[model samples]
Target: MHHLGVSLIVFACVFCSAVLGMYLHGRLPDHHLNDESMGVVKLTIGLIATLAALVLGLLISSAKSSFDTVNGEVTRDAANVILLDRILAQYGPQTDDLRVLLKQSVARGVQIISSNDRAQIASLHTLDAYKRGETFQRKLQELTPQNDMQRRLQARAAEMADEIFALRELGLLQATGTTPIPLLVTLVLWLCIIFCAFGLFTFPNATVTIALFLGALSTSIAIYMILEMNTPLDGLVRVSLGPMREALTVLGQ
Candidate 1:
């Protein structure tokens, strides 16, 4: 969600909760809540809110970190591929076929990430059998020219492919670990915030029912939005594809 819209919704939620607490107090039946009980409830809600703040803060931080980690992985993979492409050039004739293969493999890796299925990656064996580097390594072993340095460089390039692929998996794991919906992190945080604000209903007079419900509804919506931001691949807030596009553009250049 955009900043302005999210802000307004959050504001409305809190405001509605404040209004609700006042109304719910009037609707409380026979529970003549003394100031002592109200005070205790207030304190309890305050503590809950404090804990919720801590959890939400940590989750948001972790989500942002995961997103950056993925971005970094993509960039690192691109750099590895590009550097390998350049190093392959030193192999002269042996590198020719491998360079094209490296390019295609890197490009396919890029496509896998960009193609988000909200699940595991698709099989990429269709792209040049995804073994240009392996082929290059085998060919280098047979060439007995005084190009040991070039052979080593080609080996490094081949090593880079594995590193880049592994990094992608690392990033994917981190991203999902931090913001998984199954964890119910968002729902937990929202429950605390709503309960804290609805504490005003503790009064026995029963006057705040409508206000409390409105506040609850609004707060629920806000939580849903936060959840969406946390899971962009399948939610309303999708991770930007700009970085991936830039990687592709650089590869083409």
Candidate 2:
């Protein structure tokens, strides 16, 4: 689901709970509305609020970690691609075609990574990317090295290509990872309970209502950020493609 959709749902849930609390307050007996009874409820809600805060903090930390890891992998893969291209260059003019194929595969890989389309990503394993990669490998195998230097360059280039491919696959896996629905639902429920308690004791006036509304909006936005960060590639927060783009520029030279 889109981030806005999730945020709206959260807003509705918490806002409705506050409204319900207001309705209950008006109907409750005078004895039940005493400060002593409300104090106990406030204490219980405070504990729930503390637990919810802890969980939210953890969620944000985990999501940010995942985002950073994926970005690091992207940067590493881009560097590896450029390193392989340079290694191939050292293998002499015979490997020129392989370098061309390397650039083509990298271009395609970057395009696929930048795309959010499921069909394109799903067909990634069977695409021309692997075909070009295999052809490049075959050409590497066909090379007849004249010296230890050429042979070593060829071996290192081959290893670099493998690492780049592995990193790409890992990135794809990370793109599909999401926050658990159950956890989000639980968090929303806890927030609603806390908001309900806020409404129970506070006088229902314009100022109080505005405060509750703003509180719910802020909380919903936090949840939206958590969800957006969890899916690095398809949301508002995305890893930059500058590393790969720069690699391509350097390789062309």
Candidate 3:
């Protein structure tokens, strides 16, 4: 299921469980609602709550790390695009057509990545971008430079093209993958259990109901944030396009 949907379900389940607990508290035997029973329930709840908190923290950290890594790759790729274009420019007028194609490829890349659609993300895995890089390499290869300097520039440009292609491949791999769904499910289950325990122990009062609601809401928001960070491209938080936009400007010059 989508992260947003899962988050909502979690919130609803916890909220409903709290409400049900309040209703049940009125009918339960006095002994079951006694201090001793409540104490034991609280103890169990504490342990479960601690575990849930740790897991959630780890998930946030992991998602943040993944987001940063992918964002860095994208920035590096854009920088490489500009660097390769500059190299071709230095290679003399023979590469003018090749430079234009490289710029077009960069534009294509920007368009493809700007969209958050699943199909657009899937397209990243194909050779559409790589084909353009390959064309640049082929044209560079055909050039017969008159001097050592020009020959070296051609080699460097070729190497840059290869690097750009490799980076794109890595970016695609990272962008398409996500945090494990089963792990998230387990976390949500733990949260449900913890909230259920909370309901069992607490008296059904206004303050308790409000507290329980707030806790569930907060937990749901945290999960949503983690999911957003993991997806990066299509969420409340997204990877910035500053680097790509800058590259586009440089290409225009």
TM-score of 1: 0.66
- Tell me which of candidates 2 and 3 scores higher on lDDT: 2
Of 1 and 3, the candidate ahead on TM-score is 3
lDDT (Cα atoms) of all candidates against the true structure: 0.56, 0.84, 0.82
Among these predictions, the greatest lDDT belongs to 2
Estimate, for each residue in 51-162, the C-alpha lDDT of model 1 and write its tens digit.
Answer: 6667656666766665566656656756665665666666566667656655665565556656665543434333444454456556545554457797687567657656
Point out where model 2 deviates above 4 Å: 125-135
TM-score of each candidate structure, all chains considered together: 0.66, 0.92, 0.92
Q: How accurate is candidate 3 locally (lDDT)?
A: 0.82
Number of clashes recorded per candidate: 14, 0, 0
lDDT of 3 by residue, 182-239 (tens): 8888888888778777776667788998899999999888888888888776656788
Every model: Cα RMSD to truth: 6.1, 1.9, 1.9
The 10-residue segment with the lowest total lDDT in model 3 = 124-133
Candidate 1 CA-lDDT value: 0.56
